[model samples]
Target: MNKGFYFERNLLALSRFDPALCSRLSGAETTRGRYRFIESRSGESIPALVDNSGAAHPLHSLVDPRREGKRLISTLGNEGFLIIFGLGGGFHIEAALEKTTIEGITVIDFDIHGVAELLSSREYIGIFNDPRFRLLVDPSAEALEQYILDRYKPVICGGISLLPLRTRADFSQGLFNQAGEAIKSAIDMVSADYSVQAYFGKRWFSNIIRNIAQAEQNTVPLAPVHSVAICAAGPSLDAQIPLLAERKNRPFIIAADTALPALISAGLTPDAVVSIDCQHISYYHFMAGLPEQTLLFLDLASPPLVASRSPRPYFFSGGHPLTRYISRYWRPIPEVDTSGANVTYAALSLAEYLCARNIELYGADFSYPRGTSYARGTYIRSLFENKQNRCIPLEALHSAFLYRTPLFKQGDENNSWYYETKPMAMYRLRLEEKVRSMKARIVVVPGMGAPIRLETNTGDNRTADTLRLFSSGKAAMGALEFLAQYRAGINALPLLQGPVYSFLTGLSKEETIIFTTLLPAAAALKRSAPELDTPELFDAVKKYCVGELEKLLGIWGMR
Candidate 1:
């Protein structure tokens, strides 16, 4: 074997793609005492990590690292994505490549110098050549997070498993710990999004059909707004409402669904009200009756009946892949980020989408400030009051709502208590991310909850004048025709038992678009029946989605 030739080829490949890493490897020759290569019983060489003290920590079994790596990877079955926390001479990663047909494998290691030394010794051209293989040397938390978000596909990948070389991790404890935290954070974020999709995937599709028809009739006005106030239903709204009412006409007001009742009771009229919740209970927010001038903005995934509450309602597509598919293929609909999982976030997205330069946040506490769940006159208060009876008292309902989730204390203060569940925390974190990147001047009102820290860009005066309206012209195919074609497309999907990619690749352009509409529902089914194999799971999802679509078609026929 031409060992020197192989090393030169690998070095050239590294230099081409990772020049910075190649530069670090300039003279990374390993000393005899520091790292010794030992041959195993199976005739495979394994490198040992030696510290300043005489202790040597071997990453894999001394008998055979390759054999041990293959055994470990065999237990993982067929996970589409593999994440290795420590490189450990790349034995595990190489074994994973040899044993599994995974979508990708990510390797993270703290020591760039050590990696360079290892690269200089071994031929890793195979790992480097594979398009799916990724190596992150000494990656920061943000870099690790961004890489995971860009690559990890919860729907396509199914699940991801994290493998760590304990001996290697013990050598660099702090770095591995940080990398672990980054992985958990990224996974949690993706899981939360997928969970939402599972619950509302079918609902989103059904609502999009109705909302698209509604949008066709009454389009959202493409007007320019200089400034806007986004009102959330936090307890702090009680104090902010007076000030908001005093200067009501100064800025355009976009009230969240929960805040609409509070604004109305405070003798204030918002310019518009936005609703994104898929539940029927969202209807309670509009019981007081919507004003004539107050336009209603709803997500395409919202309860279809809510759109009928206002004659001037405009529908915008939220963070649903199905909604996006409809917008792309059938008709164009205004899209906004609803990922924050709260109406307040949707309201903020609306203001930003409309190009509101100066945004004043009112009652966006995100937490239940001082044990209060909602504003003074929010719909929850009236709903509980109306449902009050001998069985369930009004105070009981209010208390139950406030203390439904475990509360956590935020900030250092005697009375700074707030209800913070995992979902609520995710919502706050998402909003913080959104607010940080916004070009608008965001002003947050201080309240008895977690403080929002966002960097503002006051100097920039970007306007939405360039925002074009959706084409009002009739689509090439009407809703009925589109449904008919979609039904045929679903019916044409390849049968189960083969690889999912093979089935997916067989689909035409129109069939692919139709396939995405069922992913959310499929993901939901996959969650409940996880024991089913990929093909079987997909077949079940196809059947369930087809049934739902048929029901929608029946309803559309009656309309």
Candidate 2:
């Protein structure tokens, strides 16, 4: 068979999966500088790259490339996603696709001309035809990162493994290294997000559904302010109260839920309070009673009991998929960044959303100073005090809270020390990262906890004098009516007639939106019942969600 026939077949197969890449390859100029085809001992064609010194480096073993491919792929353990850094001959990718456990495979390589040459040399239609396989040729670091972030669903794809074709990667070492870094960064973000979803998926759904009624009535928009002060519940908050109180009326104070009680105890009322936790324990922060005049900025997934604390709470959409769907379809709620996974970070996001020019952060200590878990008057301290007995003193309770996770003792240049758990350290790092991109000027008040290093200079203090907190779009219908429509949409979805991936990919735009709203619930269900297969899980989630929606509709009618 002519090589041209092989190229045409491969191009046709490639077009089915990635038309953009196929078009690029079709127009790409053939380059013959590095790679040359040679016959292996098995009488199969193999690619070898020639260096400047005239040394030829074969991508695979000259004896048996098929065996070598199997050996290389066998080293990876049960990872669902395979990120191959270099694509040389497609043998390893074929081997990867053979494993049922591998859900997806992405091949990243530099130089479109090189990839075009490979396609012309031999047939790769077998690999290209596989639905799970994709080729990203000559992608920039940002493009690769965004692709992984969008395509690699860790929930469906259990784990990720990166396989590098050593010889091919060595040829473009710098580019490959950048690709590796991008992949690692994307994986870290996806893994963190997936873990959160697995744990709070059901809770978030329940909370959002329960709060729909409140969200409909509480449509009062908050007016943006100029200067804002955010109060966290770190131990440093105890001493920072006086400073916060001095400028209480001067700058608008936005207190984190944990810091709300402490601020009120010091006779300082915040202009607004932000809460993001989906757990029921979040209501403890409001046990101290929310000030009637102060506005409440609650995440759509916040406990409904927390929403009830305020006469008309201001609901904002956090990073939940269902909340985002609601914002798009049900109503357009203001989106607040809660990706940092901590209330302090969410508070900063709320400040930015309010269009503040100069933002001052008080009690934003991201660690426990002197083994103090929280400032005086915070809910944790009071809860512990109430539970303490003869055997378990308040001090012991505090110590237990501080030592719940592995602690890393850290100190600043001023010799002040604090203890940080892994989660706290991550939260602080995430906040610092967020600060670098923020438009508002961030000023962290000095404290005894771990120092927050702000690398960027304060941003220009030119923000709008006032902005509306919520979008102009109102809910299309009442809460019960919306739930009825949503439940109907879920029911209208086609039954699973094929594989899970095919069924998902075949969904229309509106269907996709409806399906996406159920992902968190599906994640939660999967965690509780790991034995359920993908199709079974989808059916179960659909049934469970529809039933819940029905229950909500019934309750609304009774009321």
Candidate 3:
């Protein structure tokens, strides 16, 4: 076939898959001297990159390029999202598309001109036509990271792996290296999130549905405060209590549920308390008795018992898929950032959402100082005391708790020393990262534990004049009505008949939203089963979600 015919056929095929990419290729001017087309031993046209040293390096084998492509793909595991660093000849991508176990494939390459040359030289229509394939040309690090974050769902796509064409990647080592780091960062976030979902997905769904009734109850709106203090149940809380109490009512105090007992025991009642844990163990934090006038800010996924503790709990969305769905379709609940994966972070988010101009973080030490885990009056201390006996003393139990995970020791033994586990360090790092983006001036109280590094902005710290309160807007319908509609939407979804990708692509906007809402639960289901294929997993999720909705509807009917 002529070069014109080859280019046209390829562009036509790509247009059916990615019209935007096709348009770019159509308009892209192919730069010469970068890559040259050569005939392989198999009589197939292959492109070879011309290096800066005046030498040409073939991306694929000179002989039997198709066989080489198959070999490269065979080396990778069957499950997960595949990220190809260099588009090369597109043979490996085509091979990857044929594997049903590989959920998705994204081709990342720089230079639109180089890509256009490849498109013009040979046919990539087969790879483009596959629903599983995606092409990102000359994407910025941030753009690449965001794309992976948005599309690479670990629950649905499984794990992620990268394949790089050595010759091509070597040409742009710095760019490819940056891309690798971006991919790693995105994967770490997704994996952590997926791990949480796998454990709490079912519980979050259950809690959210049950809390909908409590969330519907009208609560007093909190006026935005200029200054706020967030109390976390770190080891330093015991030492920080006197200073915290010294402030009195000067600043609005928002206590993490874990720190509520410590604050209460110190005769300091925070203005509000935030709780985001979906586990039943979160109930222990409130066993200290919630202050009567203290407002409760509970994540929609928190245990229902925790919500019941407050006279009128202020329910907010914690970025859960189902809660977001509820906010959009049923009620507009204020969203709080719980992405830090800790209650302390959630409290900070609440403070920020309240538009607090100056924020003080007390007991924010994200480490175990002097082998201490929590504040003196926190639930862990009391629980350990209750469990201790002659054989296992309180000190022994404390030591065991402190040494449960791998610990990294910091600080000088002569002054003050602390041990940090992987999770605690991660929490600190995330909070530090979050602080850099906040409009509020963050002040971390000096503590004996691991020091928090705050990179607050020097610019104006004031946020919007007015902030949104929890459950501010009226719902279009009642909880029961919303559930009924959601149930019907799930039932109305088109049956999965063919490839999962094809089925997903065919979903209407409304249908897609409904399906997206079920993803977290699907993650949990996949974690428990793992044997269920994509279609079977979808079927299972639909049945499970529908059952829960029906059960909830039945209970609501009696009420």
Candidate 4:
């Protein structure tokens, strides 16, 4: 029997497979090749064979699982076209494929020989055929990377999709080390090109009209509409989905492209979906039997797959003329400035565009209170279900690396905090601010036990009449703690002069309401009373209530 005819490995067999070693994986066999391959406990070969160069070990030109893992998780927030530079025998690719939100995976490993070895296996045939997984074979990492830049780069910066990371390396640490000088030269060449970012900006200009259209959408007269619920695998979602289900009658329902199957298995059906992913292989979940009304908003600059999508018209972003034209001639388009690039923001932006003033946020718990990700569902069940114990360390890295802890003395009640790591919170706040300032009487109400302040210049109204907590009593709260000392003294009285005089001193009646909420010197001496367990200060509370009412009135065209 010609042993040379037998291919050595399978990409889909499992992780932790070593071709040189034996494991419990059923029907697993060593290939007739002399190369090293990825190994699993079950002895399944991952088709990752390299010569006895021990090159799979870390090298100067090689990337490690940790760094690639970080990029993979970080881009999950964006959930669009995610491209990894080196295939590295699919370890990082496997890690990334684990994320549900990401629509596509483009493993651009330039080593043509390695890629050929990978695709030859029966297990890998599924990945090749899978819509969400794309495997590009080029001669070397550098060429493949350039091909990506020439190809995938524009798709990302048009605010349409994102090329999460573009790097140069051979998956074989030994091979990468041998090519260190070449890799260095390639890196220098790219870094020295100088016009890359500016070039991207120019290409992005082609999409500006959509940006303007989206900006104008804020002024559009909209009816009260329901939104899709975008959920993540975070454990906090476990608590929020029930509450979300209770209100499903209102919102049409959408989930992170990944969350779709999870929600469906949990007896839910989303009306639509959103993803910026470009690779043809990332469509597995989105293409699953969707709800009849399901509409997906795809980034226009995504891979050509977006242009070729079927059954339902996956609307391209409004920033693209093609997208705007389609929405104009054919049907209404879903183009809202999602809080950010991820599904969560996409859902929010779409909801806002639909004029759903009441947004009920659930399963948005980005925190791993229990240090676990993935709710109970079959979508991710294949990768993680049976291996939870083995996966806890990964989750631990995920929790620590992904979640930036609030800087505060541990256990201190004064340590106020929120998940600031998800910048989408700040983006949501900004969107609300824009909505409120508009003629539309819009109010965004989303909060946990803590108060999330909308940073606005309207605080100027409170600055004059508002009293500091320290001025009221010794119970100097976190504000005082933040200051480290009490110094409001006589200067504080002058700060209120503007609001106080405007409110009390012979100002016209019309002007009075505008400054009516400002507290006076006497109010500063008042007691600090707050609803128990709430963070609002009494003087702060009074001034806030008055300011909001006055602002509302102003919004209503009242004097």
Which stretch of 10 consecutive residues in model 3 shows the poorest summed lDDT?
462-471
* Residue 356 Cα positional deviation in candidate 3, in Å, after optimal superposition: 1.0
Per-residue lDDT of 316 in model 2: 87
Task: Quote the lDDT for 71 in model 1.
Answer: 83
lDDT per residue (tens digit) for residues 1-559 in model 2: 7756777788899998689888888887556656788889997788887788887788888888988999999999987888998888888888888887787889999988777778877888889877788899988888998999888876666678899999999899999999999998888888888878889888888889999988888455656778998999998999998987776357888999999998888898888899999998989988889988888989989999899998788888996878888888888888999989999999998888888888998998888887788989999998998999999998999888877789988876356878888898899999998988877888999998888989675575664345555442577888887878888999998876543455666888889888878887888888899887666887888999888888888877831
What is the Cα-based lDDT of residue 217 in candidate 2?
81
RMSD of each: 5.1, 2.9, 2.4, 30.6
lDDT of 1 at 225: 72
For model 3 the TM-score comes to: 0.94
Error of 4 at 484 (Å): 67
Each candidate's number of clashing pairs is 0, 0, 0, 29
* lDDT tens digits by residue: candidate 3, 1-559: 6667777888898888678878888888765657988889998777899877878888888898888999999999866689998998888788888787887889999988888878778777778788878899988989999999898987777778899988899989999999999999998888888888888888888898889888887777777888888999987888887887776567888999999998888898988999999998999888989999899999999999999998789999999878888899888889999989999999989888888888888898898887788888899998998999999999999998877788898889877988888898999999998888887888988888898887555525745455555445688898778888888999898777655566678888778888888899999999899999878888999999889988988877831
TM of each candidate vs. truth: 0.80, 0.91, 0.94, 0.34
1-559, model 1: which lDDT tens digit per residue?
A: 3535545666677665467766665545433454555666776666677788876677778787777888888888667788987776677888887753576788898666566546655778877766567778888998898888766866666779988877888888988899899999898878777887777666666676656556657454566577899999988999998888788367999999899999999999988999998878899899888989898888878887898897657777785767777677666777888878888888888888877778898998888776678888898877788899999998788888877677776654666767666667778788988887777778887776667777543425463343544223346567776666666677887674343443555677767667767777777777777787666766887887667667777878822
Clashing pairs in 1: none
Name the candidate, 2 or 3, with the larger TM-score value. 3
Find the candidate with the highest lDDT and give its number: 3
**Model 4 TM-score, 2 decimals:** 0.34
